[model samples]
Target chain A: MIRADETESTIVPRIEVGERLEAGFEWFEDTFDSAINWVGSTVAYISDGLAEILAIPDALILTVILAAIAWLVRNWKLALGTVGLMLFIITVDQWNEALETLALVAVAAAIALIIAIPLGVLAAKSQIASRIIRPVMDLMQTMPALVWLIPALAMFSLGMTAGIFATLIFALPPGVRFTELAIRQVDAEVVEAGHAFGSTPAQILFRVQLPLAAKTIMAGVNQVIMLALSMAVFAGFVGAGGLGTEVVRAISQLNLALGFDAGLSVVMLAIYLDRVTAGIGGGEGVLAKLLRRRKSAPVQTEETAEDKAATGSPTT
Target chain B: MTDTASNNVAPAVSVQNAYKAFGRRPQTIVKRLKEGATRDELKSQGMAAVIDASFDVAPGEIFVVMGLSGSGKSTLIRTLNGIQPPTDGTVKIFGQDITNVSPRQLRSIRREKIAMVFQHFALMPHRTVGQNAAYALEVRGISRSDREKKAEEALNMVGLAGYGGSFPHELSGGMRQRVGLARALAAETDLMLMDEAFSALDPLIRKEMQDQLLELQQQLGKTIVFITHDLNEAMRLGNRIAMMRDGRIVQIGTTEQILNDPANDYVAQFIQEVDRTRVLTAGEIMEPPVAVLGAGQGPRAAHRLMREHQTSALCVVDQTRHLQGVVYEDDVAAAVAAGAEGLTGLLRQMPATLPGTLLAELIGAASQHAAGLAVVDDHGRLHGVIPRVTLLNALADTSAEGAVRTILEEAPA
Candidate 1:
């Protein structure tokens, strides 16, 4: 290896790529100032509305409702676990911040899905659309979640709106990708059957494709929500309030106690949301299975009786 | 149903010079084909799924298109329903040219007039059997109660009456196919396209389904175009069978016509693999009785007729051609020697077979008696007779030489 001081040789000239990118961002901000502001306000309104609604219910009452939902959708075990997690958050005095975080994730994931699903459907239905959307989704997903906060902060300033904006971009790719994959993976023969019966393209998409793709799409929803939750923590750098703010505060002050409490709360929330969403996606949870069995009991008996009668006859 | 008026009625389905090529630019492939390019020459451009196919299916007739996989039979059936439009030529459903119809118009035609059954029982997994059966009507925007009622009736027709509430995955493969059949039946369309509908079922279940379909056809008289690779299935179900090879239909005819007089070597070889005993009917193989003695004639006349025909037995029929019985040579001689005046006393009961009875069922009865079995119609009128020799000959004649000779005899000069 040659010493740097021994020779002066330049193999390649330095490029102004970073300057051009910065200029591009400035130009975009300048050109779309009003549009960006309008979007920011809209996002702020949604997040604020959700946060207010979450705040209205007493924490205990909300916890009980959520636990009940968990029981109905999953099992008693998950419900009990949710109760324990909620109590822990309350005990640590992080309940309000946890709720704010929940509201932020809900808003981000909802907005992301509303846009992603249709784009996914369009991509799945048309080859040209798929080719165009795939690379963009790749770029969105592969780019660091922290990178999105830069543009978001520039557009919305330091607020919940900027946090939601970053989280929405961070969470959107899986929603679009999984939706497109799920729709495309639907049985071709089934789709053909739909067409054979003279169903319109819209009817087939709604009736056949969507129903079959429901479970997979639900998995995508889970991924979006989880991603939004993770990205919301990083949004604390922009002064977005929530558990993320506490986390930022603990990090800056080197308060280990605050860090542990906020981290535990995030983990608990993640686990609760993940299990509930997964149970919904998998379908036929313990309670659901029991209910379905009870409902179909009479039909099952009738089917067996008919089967016996069929076997008894020699005509076959 | 009069023969003369039948000519004026439009065929339920018609394809004239229809060709389907699979690729982005199917029209160019079709153009090359019409310009006398062979399938191999155009292989690089696209796959020619169907080439110059033409046929007509009459109302209430089962027209089967038979071919192995990749022979374009599936593609051909799809064209009838406009699932895959032909690259060239015309397709007509009930005399309405579908080739040029707008997509909306074609869809309405499928909704109102046509139904299809898939080989794989492409039923919606999420839907219950009843819901799956009701799907066609549902797509047509029929009321839920009305479509459900129709679906229930169709389910009953296929012997799946009470299983409508069950999901498809819960049912056996055969039962799932019943749901598929019920779906089509509920549509109540005059035309049905069955793309190897029973191909996925167990052999026993397939036979049962075939029987039920024939029984239903007897009552409903729906015009059907059935696609299958099995020659036996084609022979059993088709009123007219079209045999395809390499995207081209080589022959189209009734079962007997195709069996006894194949159009080409490929068809000849195809029929050779079919179990002749099961496919050939009594009427198809039976010959005219050697000689018939009128029931009013004397024993002497019966003996004389037997002698004149050089036969061991003779069929005795009334003036209306109703079969009385058979008078063997020995019985007639004994009656004549005993001075019997009429042939009735000497007539012996003989086993009779219906014209539609399969030869496999007649082999045991035909072998025990040397005189042969009498072939009769529903009215017990004598149609023909099947001698033991003819039965044996028919079964053994599936040899390559015999098949070649038959093909040669049927070939045009």
Candidate 2:
């Protein structure tokens, strides 16, 4: 065996890839500064509006409304968890920051989905689009969440707007990938059946493919929401105020108790959002299933409740 | 032939020189670009699913296309409706050339003229039986209430009444197939293309469905192109059967004609395993009665007739050739010894059979009657007779010699 030193085995780089990437970012920041600011401000407007709306009512009243929504959308267990988590954040004096984080996630996820789903459908429908979008998606996913903030801070100044812009970009790849996959996964025989029945191509897409792919698309939405929530702390580095700012403040001051409270509140909020979206994706939500049942107007099977929890995902 | 000659109208479906090959274009191009590639080399790059398939179906006829798996029968059916477009051919449906029509025109033709039934009951898993049946009507822009009404009628016709509210998964395999049938029936098109529609069913259910389809066809008189791999089914339902082998139709004729004169060794080997009992009717196997003694003749004439014909029994028929009874040689001898003047003293009631009775059905009658089973016309006149030896020969013969014997026996005497 030969012993080797870390510096002795290395060779000098000719291309300097990292420097070139930094230069590329600087060029993009200089060239598209106004366009980036406009997008950031638009995202900021939606996020601020959502935050103001969520923060208006008393903490108690807000908790009651959220618990009611959880009950209607999910079940009794999720409703109780929502009520408990909201009260815990309020008791720890982190209610305002928690709502801010929630609003940021909601706006970022909404925009990401709005853009990603159409691109994904385009990719699924055409081979050229699919070949082009795949490698771009891989790059978006493989890059670090914090790396997105650098460009955001360069183009849009330090604030919640920049934070939201970065978080939206960081959490977009899953939406596109899963949407394309869901559309591609539809059974070919079902599509052929549609054609055999004399359906137009557009009719086949709307009636057959979209309805069948709905559950998987909802799963993709759940992924987008979860990713946005996870990226909040990274967004805090650029002065995006929320629970993340509190954690940063606590850490700088070496206040363990404060840091613990803020971190625990973030975890609680993440769980609440995660479970609600997952329930929706799995078709376990009472409201969606009830609506579907009403349209068909058949005798309801007892296995529906069980089927809802069992499908859409196998990992759980 | 004369019945068909009187009608100068066009055929219901005519496929001319149809060819379908399966593979991507780039692969064939790459193979063609190779050095010193021969014609066979380029041919090997793509699979020929159907090669120059051509056939004509008369109006209101059950034209069965029969083949083993991979023989391109399904592909041939798909080409009739433009589901799988032929590489080079013209398919005319009700005198309209499908290749010359626009996609919109073809779609309208499919909606108005042709309906198809699938093998695996290609029903929407999410829809109810009635909603699945109404799918074609929904595509045609019919109102929901009207679609439901027509779907209910179709379901009732298929003996699935009151099943409108049931989902497809809630039904058995046979019932799901009936829903598929009901879907096709609801369209009420001039032509129906059934691609192994009953092949997925259990044997008993398949038999019942075949009978139901036959009865419905008799009443509806719709021109149907039925494709199946089962020789028995082809024989049972087809007005004219086309035997396909390796993507080509080897022979096209009635069941009896095909059995008697196969076009080639492929068709001969294809039908070698077919059960003759199911495929042969009494009319195909029944022989002319050996001796017939008129009712006005005496027992001496009956005995003399039996002796001359070298048979033990003679049929007693009226002056109009309507059968009255059978008299054995022993009975005739006894009557002759008693000095009987007429054949009525020696006459015994005959065991009669319809000309359309299956040979399988006649086996029990032939064994029980001891003399023979007499094939009778509707007017009670004896057409032919199936002796014990003939029934045994039909059940025992596996060689093509049996076909030759049938032809010889069926010839005018």
Cα lDDT of model 1 by residue, A1-316, tens digit? 6543333457655566667888999999999999999988988888888899988989999999889989878988999999999999999999999998999999899999999999999999999999999999998989988999898888899999999999999899999998999999999888988888889999999999998998999999999999999988998878778999999999999999999999899998999999999988877576656544422312435455344323321110
Per-candidate DockQ vs. reference: 0.33, 0.20
For candidate 1, what is the TM-score? 0.91
Residue pairs with colliding backbones in model 2 are none
- How close is each model in CA RMSD to the real structure? 5.8, 7.4
Candidate 2: segments with Cα more than 4 A from true spot: A1-13, A16-38, A294-316, B1-9, B26-44, B281-358, B370-413
Worst 10 residues of 2 chain B by lDDT: B30-39
- Taken over the whole model, the C-alpha lDDT of each candidate is 0.87, 0.81
After superposing candidate 1, which stretches have Cα over 4 Å from the reference?
A: A1-24, A286-316, B1-8, B288-297, B308-310, B317-324, B343-345, B377-381, B402-413
The lDDT of model 2 is: 0.81
User: What is the lDDT for B370 in model 2?
Assistant: 60
Please name the candidate that would achieve the greatest TM-score relative to the true structure: 1
